[model samples]
Target: MAKPQDLPLELLQFYLTAPYPCSYLDNEEARSQVLAPNSPINSHIYSELVRHGFRRSGSFTYRPHCDQCQACVPVRVNVEEFIWRRINRRIFKKNQDLTVHHQRLVFKEEHFQLYLAYQQARHPKGDTDTDSKEQYVHFLIHSPVNSELIEFRLNNQIVMVSVIDYLDDGISSVYTFFDPTQPDRSLGQFNILWQLNLCRTLTLPWLYLGYWIKECRKMNYKIQFQPLEGLIDHQWQPLAFAQE
Candidate 1:
């Protein structure tokens, strides 16, 4: 087998990670086709890679390389034509009191605490040690590409924090965590909408929402935002769905 480094520098090289337990599926293993970290994969390279169905975690870029599954679909919102339905509008209204700020990456104790609470509440069975500040900083704060720590505060209380990457074309949502106790506010959905609004303000064409798994209930939210573009068979296509 050829190592990623052996490939010519003019072209991006990828390495396959050994399969592990699949996080999104039960009784399955998942492998990743990772872009070797040694290359000069800056925001420009990452932006192009995402168009080819790649995504970043920390400084590494990767896509699903599972042998028997193609369930992980890379998706992005058509921010230019994104429509806010009645319920979506209500969600925006529900979060009216929250003030949003787009700032450079910084790890805050408040954000870490909320993230811990969110992980415990939302993913109790997961193996990750979300309580570690080191992992949090490594995941959300450290990045080779241009990124931001978007804060959503309600009544001056830190309710939500979203880490997103900036591409020349649009923004890619890296991760988001909120006060899981306040389920009524729908912080998860609002975060995307907020980014879409930001995309419009910047005149960007898309807002990459990361991987969307049709069989995963938690991931179903990505498709709810209409006119979703999914990378299928190495090409981007519109997912067929009726507007509600």
Candidate 2:
């Protein structure tokens, strides 16, 4: 077992071969990845890896690295410049009744039940299938650095949750789930908007939003946040509606 301190900053090099068809695209193939070991410089390494478009999972950090597909674009919102559009404002007002609480990651029965409900309602066919307590800990509680669970409540009842990883430069939205029964509230959209606001309040400039795959409809919503940047050729490029 590798201790947290044993983890490396720079990924040496890793490889993977897909089992079959890819999830993002129908005709595309999926690939695997591995990383090399550097030093256990958590904060510095995380910042560098993110700027380079890699996402963290457990002790390993990886990028798309898929040869057949370059659709997974890394996205980050410009906190200082983000402007809430009409729809976003509506969502903010809609969810105004909910109260948010932030705390360190800890497994609770209520959270597990909510997570299970969210998985079954939103991603029934997802890999985990059922959101068990052990699975919840593995997925949400397991972290190498500072992490927190942001829970939203309504009338003292838990309704939504977001797993966040804190780094020196920004906050990475590891995962988020909500009571799917409230479709009118658009919890997913609200969660992102809330996170952006939280980042602004904390003076964090970037809010890492995982990947934005143009071919994946589920991921298209990420682009709605204007004044965002995407990683292209190892550089952060501004997203523009009309480009030369």
Candidate 3:
């Protein structure tokens, strides 16, 4: 594969992957239009691709190219204009003591255990529930560009970890998992709020939240962030939400 800059100016090389199980949708298949592998996709090149709805996982960058489905809509938060309402503010206040530590993209035994427990509780009998350390490392640790493993601690005990990718215009939320025993704390919601604050603190303009499917309740939580932009028809259209 060629580097991003070395690719043709007008047409980038992309290959369609074989049909695979759709992780988000039940009883359906999924396909991806993956950008050519073995290419150097740095932050600068990735920023351009992200604007066109591509998301990164490990070293591969891909977008949904399903034959008959377009339900996975790429959405991003306009951090500069994000409306923080009373509920969100309360969540922040509650999680004020969450000490965040940023680390390199390396695997930790504790992190892997937390991942296992999280999947066991939330996604048992799923593909990731049986993931080994090697699989975990391959899924989250290996990256070509700037990536971070953010740990959120409460009272000096690790409770959550967020894997994020820093891009030119904003930060991409790669994945996150937390101690499932503390459901009342709403750590998942708080994690996104923290990342939103990080975007503002870093003077970034957008926070890519990956794909949001209106039909999937598990994926619909992203819409809670107001004034988002969704890639529809290859155009970033401003989205409006009713007041909570």
Candidate 4:
């Protein structure tokens, strides 16, 4: 086994496997391979991999490698050309009363409680019953690369939190949880909007939104963020809604 630091640039390759039981699909199986990047030139390697639609996971990176099904498309927002539409502007105003606290990855009891609430509300019939503090830390706080916890607070109380990975090219949103009781606020949409704003402020050209599946209505919201590019046939192609 090669040490993470010993991996060479030329050895970095994207591999795929046969599809297995899919997490998102009822009868489909998800197949993906480990993306090993040369850690010696970590930042440069990460930047290159991300351009190819690979997402970081701790010290290693990977993307969907499903066979026969190419529904999981990697999407990225071109920050410089992004225009906030009427709905987006309205969301910004709705969340104006909420304060965003960006901080280093830190897990607390309160965060776990909120995580449990989000899972129970959003995925009650799913495998989200495991809501222990250790599980929360392992899932969100344990990371090998630079990561941050963006907490959204209203009335001095934490309502939403997003675990984000800071890659060389752009920010990778690992996961997010919020108080599901406040459905009217639409925290999920607000989180993405906030991330886009952060990227613009930092002058980063892209925001690596993990994957978009056409069949999943829950994931379809990603397409609403216009002027995004989707990885198609190993190339980034501009997705034009007008043509659809």
The runs of at least 3 residues in candidate 1 whose Cα sits more than 4 Å from the true structure, single-residue gaps closed, are 1-10, 128-130, 241-244
lDDT of 1 by residue, 146-227 (tens): 8999999878999999999999899999999999889898889988898999899999999999998877888878878988
- Could you tell me which residue pairs clash in candidate 4? 20-29, 21-29, 22-28, 22-29
The global Cα lDDT (0 to 1) of model 2 is 0.79
List the pairs of residues colliding in candidate 2: 11-36, 12-36, 13-36, 14-34
lDDT of 3 by residue, 108-218 (tens): 888888899898998887775348887788789988788899999888888999999999899999999999999878899899999999999999999999998877879
My TM-score estimates for the predictions, one after another, are: 0.93, 0.86, 0.93, 0.87
Candidate 4 lDDT by residue in tens digits, 168-242: 667777888999989888889989899988988887788888888777877877887878889889899887751
Report clash pairs, candidate 1.
none
Ten contiguous residues with the weakest lDDT in model 1: 1-10
Q: Kindly give the stretch of ten consecutive residues in candidate 3 with the minimal lDDT sum.
A: 3-12
Number of backbone collisions per candidate: 0, 4, 0, 4
RMSD of each: 3.8, 3.7, 2.3, 3.2
Ordered list by lDDT, greatest first: 3, 1, 2, 4
**TM-score of structure candidate 4:** 0.87
Off by over 4 Å in 2: 1-21, 36-41, 127-130, 241-244
The full ranking of all candidates by TM-score, starting with the best, is 3, 1, 4, 2
